[model samples]
Target chain A: MSKTILIVGGGLAGTIVANGICRQMGAELRSGALNITMLGTSETHMYQPGLLYIPFGRMREAELFRDQRKVLDKRVNFFVDPAKAIDVEKNQVTTEAGRTFKYDYMVLATGSRIMPQTIPGMKEGGHWFYDLDGARKLRTALNEFKGGKIVINVNAPHKCPVAPLEVAFMLHDYLKAKGLWDKAELTYTYPIGRLHALEPVAHWAKPEFEKLGIKYETFFNTESVDPQAKTIKSMEGSELPYDLLITIPPHQGAQVIDDSGLGKGGWVPTNTKTLHREGSANVFVVGDTTNIPISKAGSTAHFEADVTIDNLVSLCQENTFAREYDGKVFCFVETGLGSGTYVWFNYTTPPNPGPPSQMIHWFKLAYNRLYWLSARGLL
Target chain B: MAERQKIDARGAFCPGPLMELIAALKLASIGDEVDVWSSDKGSASDIPAWCAKVGHSVVEASEHDGYWSVVVRKAK
Candidate 1:
């Protein structure tokens, strides 16, 4: 009998998995040995990393969005609906539109979202560059910013950990080009004591931060923001004043995962190596939705997709899953002036940071275009 | 000498130069060669990898002052 595979959240993770399966099991899929369906919230897939360049006026907003249908494989069926709940025992999923799907196997790729309101006074007082709207608003605020104190505060475990640092580096160059560096007091305040979660990255970045004259304040866990007063109070009661506040807010998993009792603390719990949800044999999870310590990044999702698909294919043929993910994560950090650094790491090895160079910057630019091709299994 | 067209993609970011090369290839006749000049560093390997994937032939790829130029021919 043919097995029905239902994939939730047709973003990068889900789309890549679907394409990978289609490429590997074309004959089996064509012979009615397997069927695939992908459910997503919308047809537009945003190239999120491009958001980093928006505030600098380097990339246009329109260039970041693509029709998800065009990027997905034709062999897979696509739908636009929010997943409402998962009935693990019954092997079924319920959508917000009163539709339910029965699956022999399921893949969870619903990514996380930023919750700015979680912080007191943050929704009203702070600006961020994580989203398109926020980037647009920050662009206007940055253009009007004539000098004074500029703060890039990170509130929680935000997606793409390197972004805040990249913004700081870019802002440094941007201000210098505008002749406002002399008057601007630039500061980067993070909740953690280290500049980066990875020690090697911190070591690599320390000198660059000093060279740019950016004040690095560690253990500045923001407790509240006094927007009208233009100040932020840390949990330990220290206060820092700012002329403009760009903050990365806290993140949470999809509400449906929590509603289904498949997650705790707004994150789905899964075996870090197996990519399977705890206590579920037929269901698997990947991407930012999982409670993993690695960076919640698209590169993580891309790597996870490979292992998940391999295991799923194995389960179909051998009645067991053998593939294991090693927590490999890769990222390119843009360091302004058309140059950037690359970091590669996994569970066993510490991140090896490469020096900032223009060549790596071009690779990042190439990866953005290659991502679309990758979605369709063309690259 | 065979007719060779030059595409000036210098200063353009990655895939920008490659996309321009692809578009130019679409308009060129079979056996016509197109030379692409790009300042983006990935163009050196990316262009050749793309050519290999799609069955095009790379004539010559050379480094110049702060840029790289790749020559490709429509093979099929």
Candidate 2:
């Protein structure tokens, strides 16, 4: 009998793991050695980073969503249900509809959630562009919005760290193209200093904002939003009003990870070099849901899959887990007007350094097409 | 006498060579010329295409042992 491997979540990282396992285990399955099952709640998949470009009228809503079943192979059994519980001790996962599954190996790719309801009046007043639904709502809001104070409020630890800055720059470009630059005031409010995570990279963005006349609010760790008052209060007790508020929602791990009795501090803690979930030898995690000290982006997930697949295959074969995946991430940050900034980092050593260049913009565009092709099993 | 700038983009990727040339052109005078060496397979075609679109003068474009050298003159 073939040993069963179960994977949960179907986001960017989850799909990558699903595809990786399918590609590797297909070889074994053809020879009668393995069985795999991939589980995810949604049959449709969404390209998340495209959310940043949605508000600027760069990408359409229909372009971001695709049927998940069209991408994966027909060999692996697919489950279109949410994983509500996990029994790591028993090597089983339970779905929301009371379906129970048992596996010899389980991979957690259960990405993340954006918590806007957590903030006061945020769900009602502030518009977020973190997910497909959120992007659609923000697109509608942006389409109707006339010249006024447009605020991009960033909550802590959001996915795709550069998205807020991209939104800001794109909005600046959009308004300028509309001849509404003088009529609209674009403001960016972030909890962190500068625009990006890297200091040197951040230095390049400040001038872009200044040149575009976009206002910036540093150290503005938002506390709550008062929809009726049209105000957002900072953790430091400052308040700002906006004509339209676009926010990147606060993120948290999937409910199953938090309830699995495995995650620490609401996120799966893992070794930096090994994506093995802490306190569990048979379980692995990839993507934003892990509490890794790196930017939670798609590139990080792609690199993590390289490690997780190696470790999972080794463990499955009873071989020694010998590979150490140094955390490496690369991404392109859009700077409006067909311009972009590329940032890459390798966190193998102390004070991980980020190398930046403009070529990354084209790289990002090309990679987007590559991702689509890969997901469709065409590459 | 004429001033010339040499940019070695042999190890870089697609838009990298183009961005390098653009950044260099910003610091050079109108008549100053830049020679870019790129190993990216697409650079040979992309550099010339970019020069055409942006109205820059292409002095010379040739393939070397393993890299391509494209000379661009700032037209504006």
Candidate 3:
């Protein structure tokens, strides 16, 4: 009997998992002993990290996308179908097109999405860069601005933990380059009491922010935005007025997750070490959809995908599981257009961000291009 | 004499080189040495630290040209 692996979500994690598995299980696939299939919403894959550069005009729109088919292995069966429901009890996934896929093993990589609508008035009063349309609109908003109070409001449980700070720093440099640094007042608000969830990063950013004269407000959970008044109200009873409001709105897992009764808020309960969907031996979770208390960055997804591939290969070929996933995450943070730094940590270790340098900035840019290779499991 | 294996991982980014080193070390004899050539700046510190934590020894680590060559010997 052939082993079938059904992967949901065609984003970074699913693609990587499919390609990585194919890289090792080619003989089995050719012999018809194994089948790897992926269900995705679109045929095009977007490099999400590139969204950070979009609002600032740092990257061309063409550079962020590639046809998903070209990136995946030729042996894998790829479908441009979205998963509508997941039945873990029966080990089957039903797609939006009314097709049900049964599998020996299943991978849930149905990443997260922003829920600006969850907050009152946020949909109308605020601008975001988490998606392509939002980034383009924000670009236009930045271009037309003469300069005034700019509030960068950050919400919790968003992917890419450092992006809010990265955008703030980049915006500072962007304003400076446009000769509007003095004309604009930048203020950042976070839901937490600290500048960052990571204490060390909060310490690192505080000095950098102070040096740039960027102001910040902590413990400000977003309650609503009043476009009519050009003000944002926080649940803590603080209201901030802005000429322009850029926000990192809170995120939730894909609606299919909640609809399928898999998890609340679209997040699947997953074992942190094993990457297994809680209580489902053959079901694994990866990427933003998993309810792991870690930074939901692409690197985290990539690392998790790598471990899934290893264990799946062992299970398919040897009838035994392989290594456990070390809770690992890495992220490159840009201090400005020219300088950047990175942090890497596992379950046992905390990240200590190094000093910013231009070389690291170059590496980040290079990685932006090198991401395709990484997705193919070649790097 | 301990057998030595060479890995040229200069162009790969962080974790890439380190992952390759770990894979190589797994296939190596207990007394064998693995020399990794990595251009990633983090490898300088990450390789040595990973070696120490995992009970491997860093036989030599030095910079040459644009990359650094770190040598590790499997202990167990």
lDDT of 2 by residue, B13-41 (tens): 21246545654564467888989887766
Return whichever of 1 and 3 wins on DockQ: 3
Measured on C-alpha atoms, candidate 1 has an lDDT of: 0.81
Candidate 3 chain A, run of 10 with poorest lDDT: A191-200
Model 3: per-residue Cα lDDT over A191-281, one tens digit each: 6556876667889999889999999997676778999999998765789999999999888889999999987678888887889998999
Off by over 4 Å in 2: A349-360, A376-379, B1-76
Native contacts recovered by model 2: 0.00
Best by TM-score: 3
Error of 3 at B67 (Å): 43
DockQ of structure 2: 0.01
lDDT of 2 by residue, A97-167 (tens): 89999988788888878878767788888898887777778888878877788889977656777777778
Across A1-379, the per-residue lDDT of candidate 1 in tens digits comes to 9998899998788888898888888887999999999989998999888888888898888889999888887888888988898888999988989899999999999998887887789888999988889999999999999989988997565678788888998899999999999999988986544576556777777788898899888656677888999998876457899999999887777888878888743567688789888788888888888866567888889899989888888888778776799888888988885899888777666577878899988988888778787667566
Against the true structure, what is model 3's DockQ? 0.01
lDDT, model 1, position B52: 70
Q: Each candidate's chain A: what TM-score?
A: 0.97, 0.93, 0.99
Error of 3 at A113 (Å): 0.4
Candidate 1 displacement at residue A22 in angstroms: 1.2
